[model samples]
Every structure is written in C-alpha cells, then in structure tokens.
Target chain A: MSCNVDDSDEIFDDDDDDCSMEVCTKDSHHSGPSNMPESCYVKLTADDIVKEQRKLIQNVVELTKLPGHTARQLLQEMKWSFENVAVLYYDDQDKLFAKAGISVNGEAIDAVAVRGSSGSFVLDQQTITCQVCLEDFEREEAEKGMSTASGCGHVFCNACWVRHITTQVKEGQAARISCAGETFVEGKRRRCNIILDECFVEELLRGSGGSAEILKKYQTRLIDSYVNNNPTIKWCPATDCTNAIRVTDSFDPSSFDTSVECSDGHVWCFNCLDEPHAPAECSNVKEWRKKCQEDSATSNWLVAYTKDCPNCKVAINKDGGCNHM
Target chain B: MDLKRLKKESVELQEPIEKCGVTASPIKEDLSHWKGYILGPDDTAYAGGKFEIDIVLTSSYPFEPPKMKFNTKIWHPNVSSQTGAICLDILKKEWSPALTIKTALISVQALLAAPEPDDPQDAVVAQEYKSSIEKFKATAKLWTERYAKEGSMESIQPLLDMGFSEEQAKDALLEARGDVQAAVEKLLSGA
Candidate 1:
C-alpha cells in the first residue's frame, strides 16, 4: 500500500493545500466499496454511531471493575488503528458516550474508545492518580494527599510526596517537582513554594547530620547575653591578686587590689596613682598615728587594732611611727 | 488544591522543555501535541541520521506516560516496523511523573544503546533476537546503515535493482556486517 506524503502532512498541519489535495484523493479511495473490504465498514450513522460508542465505553467500565491488572490491560487495548474512537461509560447504569476522532492510514475515521471504569469522573470534580503506583483514591482520602502539577492531575500520598520533595531538595534539584503525566508551559514554569515548604519542614524537624553546628551557635549567643547582663562583676587591679571581677558600684581597694596608706595620712590609689579615698577614713588614721606617738602605753593596743599595709605587706608598729613598720 | 498553588506548579513544569536538546516544541495554538527530533545514535550503523517523532501530552503529563510515535522511517526491533510504535515502559506502564523532557531524551538515547529483545515490538525481530544473536545484531546494524545513515536512502535502490526480496536483502546486508556493496553483490549473485 502506498502512503500519500500529503496525508502525513495532515497529521501535523491541517491547512496546507498540497496535503489537502492528497487527503482529497485518499478520501476518494475510501469511498469506493468496490476496492475495499466489507468488514471495514459497519452501517451505523449518526444515532447508531453514538449507541455503539456507548456500548464500547460500557465494556471498558465493566472491565475496569474487575481488578487492577485487568483494568490496566483494558486501558492498553483502547487504541484503534483507524480514526474516530468512541468511548462510553456507565453512569448510574446508563451509558454515556464520547467519540475520539482519529486518522488511520490516510483515512479520517472515528474510533470508539473508553477510559476504563477504574477512572472516575464526577461533576465538577478533578481527581489525579499516582503515576508510580497507578492508583487513584483507594489509598486514602483525597484531602490528605498532594495533587500533581498543573494541567496534570496526578496525586501522590502525602508521605510519598514529602519523601519525593526531600530527595529532590537534597539533590539540589528541587526545581523539578512535576507530576508524572503532567505537561507544563514550556519556558514558563518555575519552581515555587516547594522550596519554601522544604524550609518550613526543615525548621520543624532538625536534620540529622549538618544542623548541629547551627544549634551550637544559637546556644553560644544565649550564653553571651546572660553573662553581659548579669548584675555582679568586679575587676581586681593588683598584679599579685587573683583577677576577681564583680558587677557592683562599691569600690573597696582592699577587696580589689593591694591598698597603701601614704606618709601624708591618706589612702593611695594604686590604679590612678592619686588619693581618692574617703577623707574621714584617711584623716582618722593620721590622728590615730599621732595618738600612738604620744603614748608608749598605747603601743601594743595600736599594733592589735591596726591591720598590715596591703601595698607593702608590712605589719603596723606604733613604736616605729607606723611607717617603716 | 488552591488556584495559586496550581499556577505555581505549572510554572515549574515548563523548565525542562528548554533544557531537553531535542526540539519538542508544541504549537503555540495547541499545547497538547509537540514535534521532536533525535539525532541518530553515533558509533553505530545509524550515524548522521535525523529521526522525527511526535509527542502527545495528555492532561496527566508527567504523571502519566506521554504517547510517542515516530514520524520518520526507522528499522528497529524495539520499534514497530509498521507503526513506529516503541516498546519502552517509560512511555507506558513504568512512566514516572518526575521524568522530564531532558530525561526522556536520555532514555531514548539509552534505548538505542540497549534494545530490549525480550519485549520486541516486532515479532519477527523478536524471533531473530531469540534464535541467533549474531544474526540479530548484524541485521540491526544493516537496518541502521540502510535506513538511518545519512544519505543512506541509496541503500533502498540496490535491493529493488537486483530484484532481491526486501526482507532477504536486509538480512543479507546485516549478515554482511552492513557492507552495502557486499550485500548488493550477494543479492546480484542470488538473482
């Protein structure tokens, strides 16, 4: 049998004249029953064609109702060699028919086909099946699963969908998150909320391996804040003393560092190299020193009352005027 | 289920079409059908040939297998001799929604690398595949040389010239390791 090139062109572009010419000739070839087989044509026009299509669709529904394997096998057989496939389905035991137009061997014909009973169509309802398992609503409630990409209505169970998303994210290829059978706009589709969804999930449950470092940094920030805001901190200035710092306003040289009483009867500041002690505390020591000079009887008592000089590490002795001592 | 979410997902699906190397462009007027082409597999008898194929995307694309039919002439055991129907499961039962145009192209390339003998689209090729391994490989090579080679359309004339049965000439060319001249001579001697 010769294939008219023009008929092939009709498959891709319907408007070209040269192809239409060949199509015209091919049509004429089909019109003559004198050259064609009788088995090729069954007389059912208009109403009969619709009835036959409904019958075929009903057959598909019956086969789909059998089992999974049976449904799939029935689906595979839906294709016809000729044009025009009519699909019929049983709705409430009443048959509804839809016809598919096809071009077979350069001949435009109608083939009757059906989307097996396994497929469900409700008014205003669009349902998708999982491509992996080829299952629709039987696994769980429809509300619980994630639907496939746009234009394609395949759905996956939530757990399966999450796992798929996670794997894609981990691979650094999360941009592709389409359903198995859906086709998207070429050059226009972009990956969106999938990345955001992944981020939220990652926040909810810390991942196994790499997140420990982030957690550690957060803990360190907490520690730094606590220490800076604490109330008690003081710094000891003496070179020989342990560095004990407290967060307080009171300044006690004896508590902080070594202290010294000057020859002029004042407490000396070692840090500033100046005299800034309380005037009462400073002059009283001087007065006490003079009183010790006048009375030899006060010597032992003075020694018992006065503490050692913190700067020089020497005991106070009134007998020696409390300086070299 | 939300409209916004649906719109966002559709935007994501268009990405692969740009990256797929194959020209699988759908007419702007109708998005369901597309035309694509693949270069012949290299380092084989079918080098330098270009093959055209039609891709029909259903509403369930990415989730269901897209229908693929060859628009160009090809001679392969895994593709139907008459209808150019392919026997790959990725296009049918084993279809995954995650597969992209780029991946599908790679799959087609891989199909060329390894044709499935167990599930041959053409039964005669399947028989040849089962009974004689050497004959099958040689015949496949011959078919490629004759049908898929660049400017290989010349191979058709020799069989017709020598009045050799097209099938036998193809087998002989395969048996002769795709040596066109030798295949022609064999046909001439038989005549």
Candidate 2:
C-alpha cells in the first residue's frame, strides 16, 4: 500500500483518486466481486475537518442569510445535513428562525418585549423570563437582566449565563450544551441538539473571569466536536497523532479488508481501530486473542517442563535422564 | 481541571441529601473521596438495613460524574454483590453537569428501592430476582439480617424452638458456624 507514493501527502485533497488507486493496487491479487474493488476510504487531518466544517458553516450562512451562529444553530439542529436544513429553512423561514432561537435576524436576543397597553394584537404579546434563574426582567431591566445563548430559545440572567458558560467550558463541554431545563420533546436518550453560541459563551466566560486554561479547553473541545461528531471523520487512534480519517462511506468494522493509514506514519484498520491483521477476519481475530489470554498460563507452564517427543514432535514431559521412550 | 465550584456545589447539596434521610459527607478534607449511607426504603426486603456507598471525584468535578460504588454488601440487581460497582446511568455517560453529588447519591438509593433487573450489574441476583421473586425476597431479607442488622447476631435459640430434628439443626448450625442466615440457607438447600 505504501509503494504508491505521491508528493501530495494526504488523501484529503485528492480524495477519490488516491483512495481508489491505493485500494485497487493493494487488493488486486485477491479475487472478489469485480465492482467491489473501489475502496471508498479517505483520511483527513485535524486541519481538514476544521476547514470542511467552516466551509459548511459558511455555505449555510450564504443560503439562509442568517448570521454564523444562527447558521450554526440551524446546521446543528439539522445534524449538519445541509439539504434538509435548507429545505426546512426556506419553508416558513420566520418560524424556523424563531425555533433556532434567533430573535432579530439571527442576532443575540436583545430584549423581552411586553405588549403596549393601547396595542396592536400581533405586537401585543411581550415580556421575557430567564430560564436558568426563572426570573422575569421587565422592559427596563431586560437588556441587563436577560441573556440568551443556545438555539433552544431559553434565556437566563447574565450572571447565571456567565457561570453556566464558564463551568461548562471548564468541564470540556463547550462543544455540546443545551438549555439547562432539559424539556426533551422526543426523549432524553436522543441528543438535545440546541448548541450554544461560541462567541456568546466566550464573552460570558471572560465576564466571569474564567482562566486561559478553560478557554483553551473550550477551543480544543470545539475542534473535537467538529471532528468527532461527524460520522465520516475519526480521530487517528495512534497516540500523539493529531490527524483524523474521513472515509467515504461510514466504514463498518465487520467488513473485510479495510486497511487505512494516517498522515503521521501510523497504519490501522478503520473498522476496529486495531493493527491491520488481515487474512484473519476481525471476529476470528478477537476470538483468537481471547483464546491466547486464557491458554497462555498453562502454555507457559507446559513450555517450561515439556520437550518435543522425537517420534511425532508432540510435547512430552521428561521424567528421567537418558530414557528414550 | 478540577474546578472550585464542585466544593461549593457538593456542600450545598448536603442539606437536601440529609433531608432525604441519606447520610453524605466527604471522607477526606479535600471533598474528593466521599462516604455516605442510605437507610433502605420502607416495605422493601432491605428496609431497616443501612447501605454504605463509596464516592470518588476527580478534580474535573461537576464536569465529570463522580465514580460511585456500594461499600456494603447488597443483593440488588443493579448493584454488583462482588465488586459493589453500581450500573446506574447517572454515574456514567447519561451524566449532566447540572446533576450534583446529592442527586447522584439519591438516585443510588432509588436504585435499591427499584432494581432494574433487566439491566443488571449482578446477573445471578437478577436471574434470582426474575425467576423466583419469592425466594429472592426471602434470601435478600436474610442477607439484610445477617450483614446489615447493626451489631445484632442472628440468635440460634429462635431456631431451636421451631421443630427441626435436633441433629439436623445442630449440624446446619455447625456448618453455618452459628450464623442464622447460613444455617437457614443450608437447611433450605438440604430440604
């Protein structure tokens, strides 16, 4: 597989050509279904995932005319499915925008407005409550008292928001945070997709005097969410390697002959993340390893005492010297 | 990094936990290794037994769920009788940062009251609980009497009055080494 060397180091750039070439050349000797040879495997470095995610976010931004955060909220809600997000977004955009927690054209929630006494019915409904502390800040105090973060439309006191952001960031949860009052409509088991805005979080963290360490963790966690949450990408399992692998299909570990390599000089099976121990199927290899573990204790003892019998080369325990039986 | 928020949060939680009649306190001064006990809920086989729980927290606490284990011998399906490891979801990936030590311990106490036999930490106990509920309850109550009956010995005299052949009772008692539970278990198996 290493024989087909190229000046361009990564499969991420020329995804299809490099992967097909490598897979076909490697598996050429093995006879199988004629159509099955194009192994759609691609490896992506950490930078590649970041670039793709940013590109995706930018694409969303351009399509919806929503700001980066609202686009993020929409994209996250859609689980990065751009087409579905676009469909839902273009259909009843106002409802979709409100659902994505954007109050004013994807801007941060500015205020909770109350109805004017002598009022138009449509604009009459006003007033907002912070979800975290469960406090209602009137129109005058609304700007100072109430702050909204995630796409769940849940608002909180600025102080409470600061604490929440700082603590979650410190806990390596900057990547995934939802409204604290988890009113899960579908179920608790299913992921609550309301993602907090990064800038809002960072701003709040700064307000609460959060250390640089937590902010760094927050940044790392953001990258992690980009790489790890995507079904296509997987962090290279090799210790001390920063690269990630992005396969064309979600590679099943049980499937035969998946040997992929990272840019940082590490080779492994994309399926089980083990060393590419081919010819031996994955399940069989697992069974063999288990058998070795259980048999090694007695095997070690037998190796110490027994010598090969001259007749058939079977291990035989020696009882006495100079006795050929 | 271990945040200072955990200390305040854990301390804040102590009141509500105590209100629930469960004892919870940090074993060490650092508020990392904690020790607590739950008085088994009413009407259950474990009712009157005080079950101890072991808790350990990393410095990255409130961010990470504390590792919890049963220090006392318990016969519940979701608690390992051998290792005392609990299989509760709150102590693992289902953990939310909003959940505090108090809520987590309370959940453990709840697990004792309502054991999820389907998803069990102790399979043997789960099997017994599922297949022979009557026998499982009897044995569980018997264990509670043997191990959790606070300094009280299972008196042999009570068994002597119940008409069992003198030889059988004495032999069972001898085999049990005078422990009422072991003797009862032996006699039940013998029968």
Which candidate leads in DockQ?
2
Q: Each candidate's lDDT (Cα)? A: 0.42, 0.61
lDDT of 2 by residue, B55-145 (tens): 8987656545689888888778887778788887767755544456666776777777788888877778999999999878876776665
Q: After superposition, how far is residue B33 of candidate 2 from its true place, in Å?
A: 4.3
The most accurate candidate by TM-score is 2
User: Which tens-of-lDDT digit does each residue in A149-216 have in candidate 2?
Assistant: 43334445566655556666655576555433232322222112345666666655655555677777
What DockQ, between 0 and 1, does each candidate earn?
0.05, 0.13
DockQ of 1: 0.05
B1-191 per-residue lDDT for model 1 (tens digits): 12232233334434543343254555433456666667666664345566677777765454445688777656566777677777775665444444554456556655665666676777777778789867766666656655655553445667667776666776677656667788787776774
TM-score for each candidate, following the candidate numbering? 0.32, 0.56
Please identify model 1 stretches exceeding 4 Å from their true place.
Answer: A1-325, B1-21, B153-191
Judging by lDDT against the true structure, name the best candidate.
Answer: 2
